[model samples]
Target chain A: MHTLDVALGERSYPIHIGRGLLDDPAPILARLKTPRVALVTNDRVGPLYLERVQHGLERAGVRCTAVVLPDGEAHKDWPTLNLVFDALLGARCERSTTLIALGGGVVGDMAGFAAATYQRGMPFMQMPTTLLSQVDSSVGGKTAINHPLGKNMIGAFYQPRLVIADTATLDTLPDRELKAGVAEVIKYGLIRDAAFFAWLEDNLERILARDPDVLAQAIERSCRNKAEVVAADETERGERALLNLGHTFGHAIETGLGYGEWLHGEAVAAGTVMAARLSRDLGWLGEGDLDRLVALFERAGLPVQGPKLGAERYLELMAHDKKVEDGRLRLVLLDGIGASRVSDAAAPERIAAAIEACCA
Target chain B: MHTLDVALGERSYPIHIGRGLLDDPAPILARLKTPRVALVTNDRVGPLYLERVQHGLERAGVRCTAVVLPDGEAHKDWPTLNLVFDALLGARCERSTTLIALGGGVVGDMAGFAAATYQRGMPFMQMPTTLLSQVDSSVGGKTAINHPLGKNMIGAFYQPRLVIADTATLDTLPDRELKAGVAEVIKYGLIRDAAFFAWLEDNLERILARDPDVLAQAIERSCRNKAEVVAADETERGERALLNLGHTFGHAIETGLGYGEWLHGEAVAAGTVMAARLSRDLGWLGEGDLDRLVALFERAGLPVQGPKLGAERYLELMAHDKKVEDGRLRLVLLDGIGASRVSDAAAPERIAAAIEACCA
Candidate 1:
């Protein structure tokens, strides 16, 4: 197991990455404020591992209750989030009862937010069961639920006490989901780690084949990059904006297509291509660099093109993005294969053209 | 005008307590990151002051939009909160747009929570018109909505950029509400300010008569006490819990009677008497001190006796309080007239007897 700490002063916590970590309760037990916890998962992931985790904690004399929400990003709204609250309140869970999230990004996000708002604030832990969550959403403290008008429109920047990334769980992830996870893995490399980008290019097939060691290494590297960015700019005032390299466009696609139609990483993959195209038009990235970026996403079996939402519709949806400041849309565009920056340099015409060119 | 700063480091903000502070937009303008704002008010308070505040900001060239919600504590729930989010999203309000809450505690809380969660967060300002909000809720940064099971079960500890306590608005406040506000005013004195308690006892009639000078002085002192407690412990780890002296029992009464049935301060007034009775029963407070506390409530036109919900029901409701930890109920008991501490010393039967004794 490899433990990397996200240095956030008093909010700092360790991210544990390894195989079979979920079956072992010591890491979670060590971090819990009390011997009681409420585990939040979704219908998809809960049925698979909830009993094992519950029994494991119970064996150690820790009381555990499970709150299984409906699966999918579409369910990531207030009504679904309230299920967790209803269960906790119904059981009379106190502020000290640690809330453990055991699932993918949607469950983790909803549970983290529930912990953040429930009883003002409560101890939260994340046990991400998918690669997409392990490498990105589960590491950062950004917890949110979608609004009909925009994705992640209502949320909070609440950090978890610990994140348990058990790589063994990835074996159960479907091929499409695994490929979607790689989309975010590629994000770290495109944003800052050029060498990791090359490493992914070389070992994409090994990761696809579910090689345990390679997968763990990739997860650790991605978390290290994210942890550094979060530590430096926890609230996304400046440096952290770079981490949203393709998210501005990606979120538009998700909201435009309706959440869950395309996986988050899949939308990001297509959005990254659009961002690269716009960056190329601005002379920040070369054609060769853009081609390589697209090729890497395609090689991982991810979508490299967005849905057929008109340029105007995409722009309108993107306008509602959290990154929009004073009505100015800030896009994270690639400066090179290994570097990116939040830019307002691209004109509306150029952005529309890029979106049009990259759409299916 | 008295401007006192709540020292919370970067989160610190000034509380402007005086007449007509809301009409003058300079303090709010200076604190805003953008020239845009969304004013959130309730039906009851909107007709009274919404246009004046909006016109003041608009006249100063600040783009202002108004979101008026249904009046009363019953509406302080998710559906009502969604109205604010809907208005903001509909108006395409950016995260930088300042959200000014221009009403009482319900409006302030719903709006503050909206600002805290809208697009992860936005700039929040409090224009507290009611004396209860100005002297208590507006100063503390405790924003929340009530759950069916408990009051403030879902919320956040989000501070505002500036607090404009317009004492002039209190002229329109009803006699009952004015007395309701006094309940919280007396709370600050009972918990930590013996001299202030004595002052309130001597000048209670003047405050009830709405003497501008005495009212402002009372609001300033109440804010000073609350600000100190909040600044020292923003998340309510220790010292801040003392500030919740009567809140546990108070929340129970509020929840038991079905939110809008009684004003929050009225429930708290009755709760305070119950707490003092329990404290005296435990030999922590003298009989005379308890009588004085009840006398002050009676003089303020507040309810000193709670509704006959039965001690068992009150105990059941109080169990769901935020103060409960590890299945143990931590009650804030008075050591004397002006001193309080969180204690687990009272037995359940003793608490029930005290509740029975204090109920109507």
Candidate 2:
């Protein structure tokens, strides 16, 4: 098992990524404050790994209260989140009773948010079972639920006590979902690590083939990159905005098309291309460099073109981005390969051109 | 005007307490990040103060999108909180658009919570009109709404950009509501300031009579005490818990009796008496001191005895307190008159007995 720690001082937590970490109780038992635990998962993963986790906890003398929510991005909303609250309050889970999120991104996001606000706050751990969560959502502490008007419009930046990413769980993941997860993995490379991008260019087939060693390296490297960035700016005061390379455009796509119409990473995949095109229009990237980036996403079987939403609608939706400051949209854009920065200088017409061109 | 700065590092904000703050645009204008503001108030406080605040901001060239929610604690729930979010998204409010809460504690809390989570987070300021808010809620960053299961069971520790406390608005406050606000004013004195408690004893009539200068002094003193405690312990780790002198019991009372049935400060007033009795039962406080405490609440027109909600129900509700650790309830009992500390050692029978005795 490879462990990477996200150094956020008192809010710091370790992310353990490896195959078969789920079958062990030692790490899970170590971080808990009490013997009682509230395990939050979704139907998809609960049916798959719930018994094993429960058995592991129970074997270590921990009591478990399982709350299984409906699975899918569509269910990531306030009403579904209330289900977690209802179960917790119904079971009389105390503030000290650690919440264990044992599923993919949606479950992890919802559970982390629940822990953040339940009785003001509570301790929580993450056990992400999907590649999307394992590599991105589970490590960042950016827990959120979608609002009717925007994706992840409501949430908190509450960190977990521990994160266990069992790559073994990915063995059961659908190919399409695994491809979508690769989108965010590629994001780490696009934003900061050109070597990793070049590395991805060579190893995309092996990574997608679920080569355990290759996948492990990708996850470890991705988390290491994430940990460093998060350590520098835990609250997105400045540098953290660079990590959201495609999210502004991605969020617009997700919100415009209705949440869950496209998996988050798929929207991000297309959005990254839009950002690349905008960067080119801003004279920041070459056409060849942009093609290389799009080629990588295409090779991973991810979308390179966003949905045909009008430029006006894309701008309208993107304007609602949380990163927008003083009525001007702040978007993360590439300066050169492996270098990115947040800028509000892109002209609306140029951004419109990029969106219209990328959609076609 | 008296200003008390809540020194929470970067999240620090100043609480401006005086008459007619709502009519002056300087304080509000100086703190704004953008020209656009989303002003949130309730039906009750809106007609009385919203126009002046809007006019003040508009005169300073700030655009206003007013969202008026239903009045009272019954409205401090998710449905009403969502109305703030809806108005924000409807107005196309950006992350930099400041949310100005223009009412009492409920408005401040809902708006603050909405600002904390809306678009992930946004800038917000507090315009606290009620005495309860000016003296307590507006100074600290504890923002939340009621859950069916608990009061303040869901919230975030999000600080505001500025706080405008208009003592002039108190002229229109109902006598019962003013008395309820006095309960919290008295709480600060009971927890950490014997001199303030003594002063309250000497000046209760003047305060109840709505003397602006005297009320301003009371508000400033209470905010100074709160600002110190919050600055020392931002997340209720230790020193901050002392500030919750009667809040756990108070929350239980509010939740048990149904929210809005008893105003928060009324519940807190009775809960303070119960904590004093518990302190006496635990041999930590003198019976004479407990009597003096109960007498003070009586003199302030607040409840001295808790309602007979049944001892078991109190225990059950208090068990859900955010302070509970390891399934054991951590309660803030008086260390002596003018001092408090959190302890988990109170025997269940003794706590039940305190509840039983205080109810009668």
Candidate 3:
């Protein structure tokens, strides 16, 4: 088992990564303020692992109320979020009742947001059950729901008390979703960690084959990189924006196609490609660097091209992105394979050409 | 002009109370990150002050987009909140766009919550037009929307960049609304400021008559007391709960009567009486203390008796309050006229009896 702490002062929490970690109640019990919790999951993950997690906590004398939401990113909206609130209020859950999110990114994001706003705020924990969530969403305190204009347009930077990334859950993740998760794993490398990028390149095949050791190593490294960045810039006033490397473009793809059409990781993979192209055009990245970034994503079975949403449409959708400041679009573009910068200086024409060039 | 800073470290902000603070743009301009703003107001307050506030900002070269919502607490819900978001997204408002809430508590709360969630967070300012808002909601970072099940069930503790409490605006406030605002003004004194409570006793008629100096003094004192509490306990962990001395019961009254039926302050006024009764029953307050508290509320033209909602219903509604912990109903009850503490030790029957005694 590996544990990484996100240092956010009083808001700081730990990320525990290992196999079958969910089978234990001690780690989660240590962080809870009370013995009662509202376990928020989805129909898919709920049927598979809800009882196991619930029974474990119940046996340990913790009261658990299960709220099973419909699975998918499309359901990550206001109406869906209200369902969590409805169930919580129905059960008379209080501010001290710990809220445990027990699914992937969508579930974690929605549940975390519910915790952030439920009675002003409540204690929350995450038991991520997907590779994308385990490596990415599990570490960052960014919790939000999708809006018609943009993805994560409405949310909060609320940290969890604990994050348990039980690697065994990945065994049931669909092949496509697992590859999608790799997209974010690669993001850490492109944004800040060069050595981790190289390591991922060397172990891409094994990671794809569900090699526990390799996968665990990737999750740990990704979390470590994320925790450091979050600790330094909790509110994204500076270096933290680098984490959104492909997110601005990725959000456009997600919104442009309508959420749930493309998995978040898949859109992010394609968005990273577009960002790489833009970085190359800006002379920030060498042609070879772009090739290597693309090759790793391609090798991981992730999308290397965005859907055929025209450059103009993509630009329109991207304009609504949270990254836009004072009417200027600020994008996280790679300066090199292991370096990135948030730049609003990219010309619209260059961004458009990059978008056009990367589209299917 | 009187200014009180709610010391919240980095999130600290100034509350400007005066006769015509809204007429000048300098104070607001000093805190704005950008000259662009989305002014959220209700139809009632908008027709009177929106153009004046907008014109003032426009004269200073600030671009303002006005979103007029239906007036009243009935509209302080998710659907009303979405209107603010729709206008923001429609205007392509970015994270830097300052959201100025230009009305009473409902506008301030919904707008503040929108600012807290819009684009993950945006700069927010409060231009509170009601006396109640000026003294209470304007200082605390508590922003929220009412749920059908409970008041402020969904919300955030988002502070504002600046708060402009224009006493001039209160000149146009309705008699009932002005009395409503007085309920909160009296709260600060009852909780921690016995002197302020005595001042209200001496000059209650002058404040109700809209004497500019008396109103300004009342607003300043109320804000000062609120700022001190909020700065010390931002998220209401301990001391801050005392600030909600009447809010849990008040929220029950509001929810029981259907929101907006009894203005928030009116409900709070009656709720405070109930809390005083509960305190007396608990041997925390003498009988004379309860009578004095009731007399002040009555003199202020506020409801001293709650609506005849059955005690069982009030208890049921209060169970869902944010103050509830681990299924135990924790309440802010008075130890005396000027001191209060949150306690769950009051027997359920005692609480029910208090509610029954206080209701008309």
Interface RMSD of 1: 0.7
> Which of candidates 1 and 2 is the stronger one according to DockQ?
1
- After TM-score superposition, the amount by which residue A1's alpha carbon in candidate 2 deviates from its true location, in angstroms, is 1.7
Query: What TM-scores do the predictions have?
Result: 0.99, 0.97, 0.99
Model 1: CAPRI class: high
lDDT per residue (tens digit) for residues A297-320 in model 2 = 999999999999899999999877
Q: In CAPRI terms, where does candidate 3 land?
A: high
In model 1, where do residues sit more than 4 Å from their true spots? none
Candidate 3 has which clashing residue pairs, if any? Answer: none
Leading candidate by TM-score: 1
Segments of candidate 2 deviating more than 4 angstroms? none
Error of 3 at B109 (Å): 0.7
Backbone clashes in candidate 1 total: 0
Candidate 3 stretches greater than 4 Å from native: none
Candidate 2: which pairs clash? none
Per-residue accuracy of model 3 over B242-343 as CA lDDT, tens digit each:
988788889999999899899999999999999999999889899988899899998888898899989999999999998888678999999887888899
| DockQ (Cα-based) for each candidate | 0.91, 0.73, 0.90
lDDT, residue A344, model 2: 92
Clash-forming residue pairs, model 1: none
